[model samples]
Target: MTHSASPFVPDPSRYIKRSSREVPVGPVTIGGGSPVVLQSMLTSDTLNTEACVREALDLVEAGCELVRITAPTVKDAANLRAIREELRRRSCPVPLVADIHFKPEAAMEAAQWVDKVRINPGNYADRKKFVVRSYTDAEYASAVEQLEDSFLPLVELCLRRGIALRIGTNHGSLSDRILNRYGDTPLGMVESALEYARICRKAGFHRIVFSMKASNPRIMISAYRRLVATLQELGPDWNYPVHLGVTEAGDGEDGRVKSAVGIGALLADGIGDTIRVSLTEDSVREIPVAKALRSLVEQFATAPRPRDRIVPPFDPFSFQRRESHRWDRNPTVGGGEPVRVAVLEENLAALEAASAGTEIVPELGYQPRLVEEVDPEDSAALTALGGGPPRLVTIRDGCPYPPLYAFRMLAARIPAHHPILLKDTFFPGEEGDPLRSLLNSALQLGALLCDGIGDAILLRGEADPRKALELSYNILQATGNRSFKADFVACPSCGRTLFHLQETTARIRKATGHLKGVKIAVMGCIVNGPGEMADADFGYVGGAPGKVNLYVGKKAVRFNIPQEQAVDSLISLIAGEGKWVEPPSS
Candidate 1:
């Protein structure tokens, strides 16, 4: 595999955040050495002035630095004026962002009322009909001209109004032009945003931020890294603030795990200027999670690291599993096998107690005496170990570098296929807040896993062995490394949602939680529903108020079923597709 000499993060030795241009959204500033800002979107309809105002206040009170409201049409965009007026009358001055998709007029109108306006590059000036066609040089240049015509007005307007613009791109919503050229990859996501960014820069408008969002954590992580690298390649002044998130991350533990893995990884890498944890619950509920993750990054930033800089061993832009030979036959540890989940237990009795009666047992129980542990800084020792027969190797506790860097250093020194076991912490007995540990583990381990570094993971900081075992599997699932249960891609509710998303998501999960390895998507609207859920096995989407649409892999077979009967119909659809199985009795 080809490797980049420059590290993905700016400074591997310390938490030196990427140097970026500060963009002001109202009074709050992002990037330019600013502490990462926290933000969330309102679920209340834009037309409901009172509800929108109340939700905005609630989010601000819950520590949301910026609030976003959806404006799907010109009328909805106009309503943002009322929401803004109401918020100001109540003395809540949190800067508001208007989310616009497929509507340039709405973006223009929203810009008049809000502090910032967000436009999805995939749909801002382009249509998404999933059409497949080739664009010649002439056709492509014409498309770019059309995009400039549609987007330049907004750039000019935002410049005059002193409003910031977020050129956000989603994985599933790439325009046919981008898809045909870039093929729905992370590179496509970054290129989509940069196309609009080029227009803003040409207009001499610098109040801009960017987000590369996806439901899958691995894709989200890679897209952000690629965006940063691409921006670096463009020029020194091209460093714009970045907003990080994993969109359509479902509710509860699953949602938190996914968000932490994606957002936390980037934060640890010192790439994000602002962050939002997109949970499919009340918008206010998202703040605490974001706060926890931010706190973890802050603490890591303050902590000391070795003076020497070490380069990353693998490519950060793409997911290429490191070549490794088969190290074990039973519950395989390497050789193109699924990443194994393991636990750090002293003996068999403790392992039994922790994983007893659990189907998701650790494949390997690591005891210090049985496995070889090498000093992370000692490359000579690691090379000597690599010269011998392949055996399980890991960083010994108390490495000078941080856990994340220590592992990267080890990966660099060892053979490509050494089957290294990853741990959340390299230091023993360093424990405090459970939430901190959870987020830290996700950030460090998730960062490595997404980089295709880890073959096995151990949650060493978690004291509760059962919880540790469960979290290890959750991290694996969130990183898209493995799936022990059904997978979900549910979007956080916004003003465009037609029905209660939290309740519907719970109902669907209850019915299908038993289907192992099944990938399902629960979306609130078609704004991003059909495209975002393209990789899902089945889709449960809101068609309208109390209405639902079901799809079997990008094709909607059932439309406008009443919300109450939608779950049953979905089950039947799954069975019809030969994917449904009866749940095992408790």
Candidate 2:
């Protein structure tokens, strides 16, 4: 891949953050060379004014730059006015964003209250029953005209009211029209957002930021890269800011891993201006996660290198591990093996107990003093082992490449064959904060693995070594690096769920947890079933009430199986495919 140069940045910086028009949302400013902003959503029901106000205040207190509340209806959009007023009264004047999914009227109404309005171009004016039809060129143009007519009034009103718009596109929610023509691909996601962006531009409205969100990090990264490249091709005058996120990213370590993989990969390329970490936990808790991820981005704000070194070893626009001479250093790591796990905890005994065969780099002098390069003698001494020559599993570095720019500079100087253990120190926010430890480790390490950069992941934390090891593998598995056990790609149940998602997911996971390397998806509804499961090996999606549809890859193998029998049927399907081995009886 070659780096394309442009005039907007003059010299070395053009290769960094893609230039975007400075979009203002009340007191906060993003894009146009502004610092990367952090955002989160309010989970309280929009009708519950007290809860909504309370949640907004809590998020702002936690360093949330922009707060979005779901406005699924006109009334919910109306409640935002009181929520905004109350938050301001409480001295929390963070910019409010209205998340409008389907209703154009709600978006118009929300613009009257919130500083910014985020509309999903996928579901704004189109439907998603998963049907396909051919569209003639004339018919498509007419559809565009109708869509523009529907959106122009809001654009006009937003311009008059000084409100910003985010034309966000979701992978699972693409309209049938876009899907029919482009299929469910990254190009489709980009086109879906650009369709609205084109109309907004025609109406002389420029206060727009765009996002392409998917549960899968690879697709999310590719789409954002393609979107930026497409905009550059369109012209520098079409500069628009980008908001980065990965939607429906589950919960706990898995969610954090998925979100980090998608969002971090883009930020490393200097592509994102504002970021939101979508977790299944409390919205206020999301702020810390966003800050942790953004730290890496800020650390590498400038272009890492003059154009040539801009792209990493592998192509940034696609997924391909860099070419390297294999090193069979550790049994599970290096030599083209699946990415390995390592730990640097204080308790040597606990570390040994947790990872029987895993490598443990000493904590002393691990944090780099120079931040760039270390003396060669010191590096060699650190990696020197008593056992016949140091293996590739262990690496000695001056400092951690928390930012991609640092990584690029160091990778250029280091040996390609030597396996490197990327490190991130996990920080649990406060005492008694559940999920904090897991989320911190996942986002920090999973970010690099998603880009196919690391040979092994190292999480330095104070938890039990076994827990840290488990968290390391979970991060790797979530980022498609390694799988130690069955991977459950379940969605956080929404209102349309047919069965008890939490209990059913637990049951399915327990029953099949022994099947190593198998990816099983348990989705709550047809709305988020197949598309959301993207690369899952098998799927158990909600069909009719109490019935589940089973899938192999994207094809449904069984239909309408009773909820009580679904888990067994899934097991049989796996056995029939030679993927199931009976769990040893305790």
Candidate 3:
């Protein structure tokens, strides 16, 4: 049955509906069967009204339906009124969302000025110091009661001001109390937001959306899935809209691919209502990526629910690489190996033409043909004419349809077990920016890779062959499917960062750029360092003024080392662990 976008109506449908309550952020409706909306954030300083307005307008013009600005203090939040007024004067009326992390007063003040306010549950009332403490049941109850007492005013203010609220939880920013109980896991992330959500619900504050963001796609996807599953247990009334994002995803191809993997995986499960492709780049650059993802969801998401499809046996809540017992023809195609990249060769002439200019690596294969329309006799024809089995089955794009949707629909009709190549074709927009094409390619193909689908990626269009090859590898590495070079996890710094994160990250990258297959994280402070770098092999974190804390995984192996000597110490730690290799000649 269909659901209405009204607070009084209950959404009972699964999959597309996600059984979530409807919330209105300005004129845009989220959850309760509403179409997924697109959003992005302004990176400029909030106090800089001129810069913030320009960036926000750019984001809006680029198709961002909702724009968020950070308000770290009372005054910073007050300036939100100026930003909103200026946008109105300039003829852009996009809804504004104020991002609040540590200040409750700012949340209260921000609510009066913007259309929406987003509060981080981890730091709204408490700062984390990794302290360990034990609490009696009475004491725990008392602490929660105090928090509710404090949070009730803000909830009441939102109700009076007609503003929406988002209880956003970041994977790396969970407080010590949460860690003490849940151990920095996805369950902990969900509980952090639920604590605030339960408070809002108790106070009749239902104009809410929730987000579980993380830098690691695997962790982010798992946390959101766990959030939905937990909410499902609480019954139909608890399903609020979820805002999907991969926070602090780094620049260019890396950023786009990482965001796609997390956001797309969730959207594929029909779990998200609004999406923000959180790239550490220009705010306007994020809009196209967000729209592309929205388009993908609209194109492929079926009404009867993809649940009916004969999907491969795999768990969505946990990270499990897709597996197969045997390949029918291509014996080396499946059975749990790192995915291989292949080039699509349609006809013999096209293959000959491409081979003349393309670098033919010894390992790369050129598939002969791709079947689009399935005929009743096609299986019989294949069996009768087959000799040694098709090396790889390819799904190509000859029409305007999305390659991914085509891939899925065609693959479902074929065998239950066979490695398929997802051949995504791309053409630059009217602007002729090759970067846009690259972003779209990653948005479409990266989604499949993140879900453990697609055996190979074949890029087609007018871009340079060398660039295509590099981008293919980058997409694979970004999605955690494969890696061939140094992977760096650097935080997007805020007011809390103690050092120059950009320059220091560059310095660390220069010294360790040669260590292939090694993952390094450079964090500005302890706030997001330890938890955000959950997957990094080693971490370089700012501990205090001019001092650094180096970590092997999440454990601080060396504490309080001088800033000048920190890089050397990190190297030593890596070398000590036998994971570092000497750099070749400069």
Candidate 4:
């Protein structure tokens, strides 16, 4: 049943936490087999000491282990002293981290006050004008030398101050140097951080954490796996703790589903040390979602084992949907078809009632009488169906293997023509608790979807039929398997945001939520804007206070539109591009 294993993951079959070297952040310890740490960032302006202090206190009260404040300028960075002093005066001892971008001066100023400094390797030294040009070997080496000149001092400062450094890289913001070489890929994201890691190692600095973030879960997951695999290849000392997140994960259920899929999938593979569920809302609201996600992953511990050695059927670092011929044409499944959604027979009416005006509705309902169920561990049972005519088959619940491994086993043994139906639960447990139910379904089903295993998904456990239907489509959207509504990639607000992100996001969503298949990105500032919104069809970004910048793909097409007209302008941009359709009127 098995041959070789991927160096990226030791065993993709179960939840065995990956071992990492412990790095200290003030009073908290990350990695070294420690329980996963929870962290969140402040949305208040750094210049406003009282607001920053208040938000920090709220996050700390909500059980956040680490609090990050953005420092977009030297003034903002210097203001961290006042915020830190106030927190200390209040007797709050939570570790503080300064989020820095494109400013070594700010990072240097921040080091004096905070417990940790997070630097984006993509923009820390390199300017991202989105320039593309090939470099000769000598030219590339010179760029590296200059980068070290600017970055090595920070490494020395962190070492001297006895503080930790996180060389975080965002998939949307990789440097032009990396993009020219590796393209905008997970490999590029990994190498961007590795360059800084090499600098830290050369300078004998060991207190470090690493993160690979993206708005897309597939890219985020792949970057982290490639990074860890690269570290493993670098030898024993490169096991720095990892911080998992999916950046700009919109708000509400969409935000939760995306965060759960991205963070929960990696946790399922045993790969996170710390996590932040980035949402476009109040910072404190993110903590419980993070905790719920951790709790949901804990359930993976109860997963049953496979009868034999399980061989991975898909690449862990890249997404290439598994091939299976479509058995039905109208509501397609497999062989390059959009992943379909299904509901239980009894809940079909509720699903329809719940999805009255929504474009994303269930394509099928599970009729147990028509579909044959097979236990994954029963090899003879799977073999028996191989010679039969193509039909819709579903895996049995309460199997020896969890759905993640169960589906893998089934896919490995069965013929490609038979379409597989995926269910949220592989075993029955408690019935209530919608939050845990959403997290569990996202983790289990999303993990399989990311691995390119599921053809159609049936969400059980969630008692609200409408909520379950929404979760099903949201899971598919988050996994990049399908999109039935306007796709949004929004950043959680920080000190750098120029406008009210929460209100702006809500307004923009109201205007464009009806536009099916349009990918829109709403960013707070330039730091995570242009590049982060690379995959979006239209972008609404903060250019300055009371102003917005609009983009078509990665190129900025409109600038300095008053924030009052931004949503309308975005609609016009979409309309002008022929993506706009009249919203249904009551």
Using lDDT, give the best candidate's number: 4
Ranking by TM-score: 4, 1, 3, 2
lDDT of 3 by residue, 460-496 (tens): 5325555566677777877787777778777655444
- Candidate 3 off by > 4 Å: 1-21, 31-35, 85-92, 131-143, 301-308, 326-331, 344-362, 369-420, 425-440, 454-463, 493-510, 524-527, 540-579
Model 2: weakest 10-residue lDDT segment is 362-371
Error of 3 at 548 (Å): 7.0
Q: Which stretches of candidate 1 lie over 4 Å from their true place?
A: 11-14, 329-331, 346-358, 428-431
lDDT of 2 by residue, 1-586 (tens): 2234433223222135667889999999989888889998876678889988877788888999898888778998898899988988988879999988778998999999999998877677876666878999998888878888888898998999999999988786787888899988888999999899988888889999999887777778878877887888889887899999987676666777787778876776678899998765667767887887776556555423433333244454567664334544334445577665554434544555554543322222222331222322234543343234223433234333333334333333355555555665422223433344454456456655665666666665425556666667767777777666787777654334578776887788789987878888888777567766767889999998999999997778899999999999999999888899887575
Candidate 4 lDDT by residue in tens digits, 1-586? 2235687777776666788999999999999988889999999989999999999999989989999999989999999999999999999999999999989999999999999999998899987778879999999999999999999988999999999999899987889999999999999999999899999999999998999999988888888989888998999889899999999998998998889889998988888899999999999999999999888777676766565766677787778777777767447666667788888778777767767877768788788776779977677888888756667778887675557667777777787778788888866555767787887788778888988887899887686677778889889988988878889999999988989999999998898988888999999898888988868898999998899999999999999999999899999999999999998895
- C-alpha TM-score for every candidate: 0.96, 0.76, 0.78, 0.96
Q: Comparing 1 and 3 by lDDT, which wins?
A: 1
Candidate 1 lDDT by residue in tens digits, 354-424: 66655567777777775679987675787688566667788888766567767777777777767878988
Collision count of model 4: 1
Candidate 3: worst-modelled 10 consecutive residues by lDDT: 1-10
RMSD of each: 1.9, 6.3, 6.2, 1.9
Q: After superposition, how far is residue 109 of candidate 3 from its true place, in Å?
A: 3.5
TM-score for candidate 1? 0.96
